[model samples]
Target: MTDRELDEILTTRWPAVMRRVIGDDSDDWMQGFVKSIARHSKRPSWRPSAKQAQLMQRLVADLSAPPEPAMELVER
Candidate 1:
């Protein structure tokens, strides 16, 4: 995809997914992932490689999946 499109995804779409995945907590891994993607997108020569695009798509899918159900203990 074009740099502009990537930038839009990174700026607009990704943050929403991040919020869903991590809530308000400071997740270092997520922060670093965003920073890395942003850095690449900002580079003059950068456009998302096919693998990068695929990875982003997978991440969105994974993050958007419903949260696992919590289990409760029962007292006898």
Candidate 2:
């Protein structure tokens, strides 16, 4: 993927899931994830393998899913 595509995925698409997973630490986690992707992309033989792409696609699907209802405690 092009750098722009990667940036869009990291910045626009990934934040919601990151926020849900990391709570208040989402920004820090996102920055680190972006950095890792950049570093990997810089390697001469680096390209997203099919498995990597599939995993990312699955993550996006999971992230986009509607959250389950929160359970409420009932007093006896």
Task: Give the number of the best model, judged by TM-score.
Answer: 1
Candidate 2: residue pairs that collide: none
Clashes of each: 0, 0
Model 1 clashing residue pairs (backbone):
none
**TM-scores, all models, native as reference:** 0.54, 0.46
Candidate 2 has its poorest 10 consecutive residues by lDDT at 17-26
Q: Which portions of model 2 show Cα errors greater than 4 Å?
A: 1-11, 15-35, 38-46, 73-76
lDDT accuracy of residue 40 in candidate 1: 73
TM-score of 1: 0.54
Clashes of 2: 0
CA deviation > 4 Å runs, candidate 1: 1-8, 17-31, 73-76
How displaced is residue 70 in candidate 2, in Å? 0.8
Summarize candidate 1's per-residue lDDT along 1-76 as a digit string, tens digits: 6667667678778877666545656478766665577667666677677987887777777776887899998999
